[model samples]
Target: MSQNTLFDKVWDLHKVADLPGGSSQLFIGLHLIHEVTSPQAFGALKDKNLNVKFPSRTIATVDHIVPTDNQSRPFKDTLAEQMIDTLEKNCKKHKIKFFNIGSGSQGIVHVVAPELGLTQPGMTIACGDSHTSTHGAFGSIAFGIGTSQVRDVLASQTLAMNKLKVRQIWCKNRLSEGVFAKDLVLHIINKLGVKAGVGYAYEFSGPAIDLLSMEERMTICNMSIEGGARCGYVNPDQITFKYIQERQFAPKNENWARAVEWWQSLASEKDAKYDDVVLIDASQVEPTVTWGITPGQSIGVSQKIPELKELSIDDQFIAGEAYEYMGLSPGQAIKNTPIDVCFIGSCTNGRISDLRVAAEIIQNHKVSPNVKAFVVPGSEKVAKAAIEEGLDKIFKEAGFQWREPGCSMCLAMNPDKLTGNQVSASSSNRNFKGRQGSPSGRTLLMSPAMVAAAAIEGKVSDVREFLKK
Candidate 1:
């Protein structure tokens, strides 16, 4: 059992009681909902005739099924229209705050909550979306639950789960030029294997992590679930406190100082014990991209795919499945894989920083023929900021469509979807089968800048090479 690590500390602090079946009854400080998942959860509550517990702690938004192209009410997709209507109805009945389209605050729920200061240090955040862990970048413990668990939180504001073991991932050295948090996480996931994090909550720390901005940290933590971890978080620091100091829900001047004091104290102690510790050299990580179905089936830009025999027996089986699905032979270099589309957005890497990096790369460059590329901001605020900086013009000039804020093409629940077997270079977190909206639609997961490079080349090309030229 780990002692005094951030996971253990947060768990112990928020644990309301120990429950039967070896699970703890943990209290949630924040509950975020979206149109897609919350509708069913709210319906379940109505079936049970139960009122939401602690409605003030919960916030709602529309993202997953929202169309980035046309967000007008009475949406073209009747299913999406119904979902948003349900959320509005539920929030009204429960007296909860909702950030709807035209509200200026509407966007991805995970992105909106933190930017608005609704997610704070030491809070236990939950949502019905995998990237809910994005909130953990603020030093909060955030969990992504299924629809059933969503109902649980909506009704009781409590969760039943076995405690997770804490794994300290210590990253040493500085990232090389052009590399970002997305690359570092892909490196970790590929090295650790997808299942290695199944029973743990990762504590992302060390010099490399410390150097990343709050948005960058969110990108790292957002994909924690992709590695199969139940949750992940960083310890609160001056950076964490600074990011939340002036936002709407965060404490005011004197209250912020007091909140900062409390938040700082939540950092894991120097001698804290952990279930395991893994050290990674940040200097060695290159621009990474996912070549196969799973997030773990990734390689550095300069590397080749692993031969199935070189992996563990189980991993070899997993690799075999991936190879068949991805239509890539073993030992082939991941570079120069043909791509038909490029996507930029999601809870993982859809912030203003991501857009800035991609637009910087595509500024004076033209996209290749037949490549359908676009950028979707994580929130209305991110889109507004990009327009303010002229990032939108750069992208448009490079032949990338600048769309409204939403989880566009990440899960393909909306109109922004891939056709046929066309492979996409995506900045979103997941690369699962049918993830980009087509069962046969392939996805290559990379950073936003890398996506831009792929878009310009119409293939899975090396981003660093473009920079050098």
Candidate 2:
């Protein structure tokens, strides 16, 4: 058990009661819903004859099924159209706020909420998507829930769960030039191993984390679930408060000061005790890429894939499967592996800053003729910001398609998908088999800048080379 840590503070603050089964009844301050998961929970509510207990505390957005292209009403995919329609009706019936497509606030639920300031420090946030931990960047205790849990929150605004042990990952030093937060998180996942976080909540701290921007911190927390952590968070600081101060839903005037004061008090005490601690040197992390199925099966761009003997007994089986599925051999260099498609979008890395980084890299080079590349913003706000800065123009001029906002190729629920057996350089998280829609599609996860460099070279080239040039 951890003492005086941010996780403990937030959990204790929201704990409604200690249940008979040793689980705590935790009240969720924020509930974010999307088209894919809400339909079932809303249906469950209908079956039980219950209305949303706190409609105002819940916010709805359509993303998972909404196509980034041809978003015209009565979507070509009847199922997607039906799902969005059901969500609209449900929100209307419940009087919950819905950020529909073209609403200017519409986008991925994770991206939309934070940009709107709906995510604040010390709050317990839940979403039906795994990456809901993305909101934890604000020092909030946030995590994804199953459909049943979604129903629970809608009905009672609370969840029943055992507390997670806290692991303090103290990152020393700052990232070197050309290495971004994506690379750092990948490095963390690779070093810690994916399952190392199985029963813990990660507390990301130290100088390296402190130097990162809010969006970068979000990228770090967003993938905590992939590491098997229940949630991940950074202590809120000036960076967090500044990012939230003027947003649409953030506190204003006198209330703003009170909020910041309270938020500061929620940070982990200087003498906090954690169940575990791991130290890392962020400067050692290079531009990284996933070479195999799991995010943990990754290597630096300049490094070679692991040999079977190099892996532990438990990881060897999956490593073997990954090798065969990825069409990669042991000790093969990940660099210069030809890429067929380059995708830059998703809740993980579709912010305005991500687009700017990719655009800056792509501006001087055109996409290779052998590669298909595109950029999808995380939210309408991100899209609008990029357009204002002409990032879309830069992408288009570099032989990349600039698509509308949605989840895009992240999960490939939409039209943007990889064809059979195509190797993709993706900025989005996850490189699981068939994750990008095609049963045989191969995804290599990397930073947006790395994806841009790959798009230009038609291979997994070192982004540092581009940065140096």
lDDT on C-alpha atoms for all candidate structures: 0.89, 0.95
Predicted candidate 2 versus true structure: per-residue lDDT over 1-469, tens digit per residue: 7999999999998999999988999999999999988889999999999999999999999999888878999999999889999999999999999999989999999999999999999999999999999999999999999999999999999999999999999999999989999999999999999999998999999999999999999999999988999799999999999999999999999999999999999999999999999999998999999999999989999999999999989999999999999999998999999999999999999999999999999996999999999999999999999999999999999999998899988999998999999999999989999999999999999999999999999999998898888
Clash number for each model: 0, 0
Candidate 1's C-alpha runs over 4 A off are none
Q: Give me candidate 2's TM-score against the actual structure.
A: 0.99
Count clashing residue pairs in model 2: 0
Q: Give TM-scores for every candidate, taking all chains together and pairing residue i with residue i.
A: 0.98, 0.99
Candidate 2 Cα RMSD after full superposition onto the native fold (Å): 0.6
Colliding residue pairs in candidate 1: none
Alpha-carbon lDDT of model 2: 0.95
Query: What is the Cα-based lDDT of residue 386 in candidate 2?
Result: 95
